[model samples]
Target: MINDSELILNADGSIYHLNLKPEDIADTIIFVGDPDRVPEVSKYFDDIEIRKGKREFITHTGHVNGKRLTVISTGIGTDNIDIVLNELDALLNFDFETRNLKSEIKSLDIIRIGTSGSIQGNIAMGTILASEYAIGFDTLMQYYQKPYNSKELEIQEAVIEKFHDLTFKPYVAHASERLLKKFAHDIPKGVTMTAPGFYGPQGRNLRSQNTYPHLIKQANTFKVNGYQITNLEMETAGIYALSNMLGHHAISINAILASRVNETFASNPKEIVDKAIRMVLDRL
Candidate 1:
């Protein structure tokens, strides 16, 4: 039995951070990093059954094409993913009435509907990318044990070698194959590198200097076993890594908003984002 002090639930039986109960979410969930984006995704549902919000965590559960589904906001970053995934696991695996573990557990299908920048020049703006691998440049996954096998060593080595200018060690984790087969067929497959922040961590320059001046360009050209680095984002690697360990299936669908290779931004990003969101919703 987990103690109430450590595994706290609200008096109303909702999870503390998400203000959600076991029934509030469906096993198939679509996660967006922005709070406002939650409704945008849920608006396509046939009928919304539940709506809950707390801090940056907003959840809307409903039916789409006779299938029950959920759209939730995770704010941003893997740090928030740590909170969201654990609380979600606890919500399903713990008995709210008894505050004890359940004998049977359930796995979730967590799909991220978010935005990213294309590191490769050929990937046009507004293209939807299916992450074959989400590599983390952040230190979040390093806090855990090793997440790769011998096969991914070459991919990991390539990331480390290309981003050598940075101080932290990088790790690579692949997306859920089950989810990929179902959703990403006929789409452009690429590796997504998740940065810890929006600026310097992604090689942006301002007052402070960047350790890797042409980091994005470097990642764009990186190739190992003929698989090239495709894009950059902030949440995919965290989502993939945590979900892999937590028994949840996860995948990220990215809207290309910028092109680092050509120094271009999407002329109408929300249009692209909306297209990407609808694309995932249609498949989900």
Candidate 2:
């Protein structure tokens, strides 16, 4: 049985942060970073069924061609992802009435559609990157055991060798090949680095100084077994790692909005995001 400390629910018995009951969500979930983007993605749904919002987390479930889908907003950053992923798993994997773990676990298909900065010069602005693997520069998964696999170890070792003095212990996790082939098989695949912050962690220095000024340059040049660090975002790693531990299939489709190599940003990034949404929905 899950303790009350770990399993806090609302008066109506919905999940705390997400404020959603199991019936409100679908097996296939698409996560966005912005709350308002919830409607943008659900607009294409054939029929609207459920819509709920609490804090930065918003959920909308609908159907297309008799197929049900759920689009949810996770706000931003891996911190929010930590809450989102765990709560989501709880909803499916636990017997809420008894507060006991379910004997038969349920697996969900989770896909993150968000914007990212291109670390590779040739990746181009306004392009979409399908994250075959997510490299977590953040330490969100450090508390958990068995976080790194063979592929992840090789990727991190390569980065360490390239930047001998680098301090971050990065972990890599691959996207679900089942979901990858379903949604992003034809697209260009690359590895994504998930930073802890928008600035210093991603090697972006404004008025504040960054300890590792060359972190971005070194990471972009990192490659192992033909996988290159293609872009940077803030949530994919946590999503991939947590999804693996929880037995869910996860993938991230990134819209390239910034060019870290040439220092260029997208002027009308919303258009790019829309394109990505349509692309993912088509596959879904």
Candidate 3:
């Protein structure tokens, strides 16, 4: 059995999975999927103090515009978000030495900067799309037992009923409005659709049998009230869900590098990503 004592670290010791101690992180965090992007993001930090990595997870803690922040790579998908978000919460809210809770909880502000495909035709290449809400098509939420908004649940139920032929259950959640406001002008805002995979899960071409053949069309045309599905990504739903549950403010900004319907990729993907990152830094 894994004991709490064993799971917990010494006050000055680092976390088991992230290899990071409390002092290694700041209250503001930027999450990316590429390990290399950790350095790419941290390069803009005014004064970087710590850098660490394990497997696909790389971290750098520093100051940007006088604000202390940590840039971490969560690899890809909600499963990785499960690990990173939980560990980050523990690092901030738990007493590492005693394996007990702290009197006051520290809520971190998280922003995910990643690449995604545009679902809407008008959302062009090199554009940055911020997620106002994320529709999760993953199973991570089955583990949680909590109350959700009634209107959101109704929308999710309708979506599931509409796509009953598909294999997975639909999950939906919204990003933090506070974070959205903070980064609003930094990137174009839209509703981001989160899927399970880049291929079959997202209605892409495959050699074998596939699921949700009309998913792209359904997602693209589907709108909740007037909000349209603007982009497709893998991690935003999980980030929104976990961040909401943990009382952290979180948002995702996707650089539109691909258009699934048109089979086109941004000619200058790096330039687009760099521009998005620079805008985010300036806003921070």
Candidate 4:
């Protein structure tokens, strides 16, 4: 039996951080980074059943076209992704009363619908792109025992070689082939670079100076085995990495809201995100 500290549950028996019980979610889940966007996705649901939240995590479970779906917000960053994924897996595969793992594990289909900035000019603003692979420039994966395949290792090695002077190492993770084929096969697919922050880590210099001034330029030119860093975002790599580790199928569908290459931002960011949301919902 797992100890209380290891598998912490609420007084009501829901998961600690997510404030969600096993029955509160669906097998197919959509993840949004912003809490406000939680309703944006859930609005399309035919009917919403359960709504729960705590901190930056807000969850809405419902159905659309007779298909059950759940949309939850992870706030931002891979750090939140760590908590969200683990707790979600626990809800699905752990017996909360027993505080133990179930005999049969269940894998959830996780789809991330979020906004991003295109690093490449060809990927215009308002375009919907799917991340076939994501390279994390964060330290979240370092704490996990991640095993990479030959393709993933090659990409990781290439990133390490490029950013050799960096203090920490980067990790590579791919989207689930099943989910990718199911939801994003027809769309433009490329590599996404998941930064730790919006400003410096993403090469954005507002009032502060960036250590790597040419970071975005370098990312635009980066490529390995035909996969280039196409866009910059904050969550896909974490989502993909943790999903892979937890035996869940995951994919990130990005609505391009900014263009680093063109130096432009979407005039109607909500409309862009809405289009992506509808596409995913229709596909789902």
Best by lDDT: 4
TM for every model, in the order presented, reads 0.95, 0.97, 0.94, 0.98
Please list the C-alpha lDDT of all candidates, in the order they appear.
0.87, 0.90, 0.84, 0.92
The candidate maximizing TM-score is: 4
Between candidates 1 and 3, the one scoring higher on lDDT is 1
Ranking by TM-score: 4, 2, 1, 3
lDDT of 4: 0.92
Model 3 C-alpha lDDT per residue in residues 1-284, reported as the tens digit of each score? 33665465534478877889888999989999999888888998898899888889899999988899899999989999989999999998887767777889889999999999998888888888889878888888878753568756866877787677766677778878888888975567887888778788888876957756788888877766677779898999999888888889998989999998787998898888888788889888
Model 4 per-residue lDDT tens digits across residues 1-284: 99999889889989899999999989999999999999999989999999889999999999999999999999999999999999999999999888889999999999999999999988888889999999999999989987677889999999888877678989999999998998998999999999999999999888988788888888988877788899999999999998888889999999999989989999999999999999999998
Q: Give lDDT for model 2.
A: 0.90
Model 4 steric clash total = 0
Candidate 3 structure, TM-score to reference: 0.94
TM-score of model number 4: 0.98
Clash totals for all candidate models? 0, 0, 0, 0
Per-residue lDDT tens digits of candidate 1, residues 100-193? 8899988999999899998888999989999998889889877886457664678888778777877888878888999998889979999898
Better of 2 and 3 by lDDT: 2
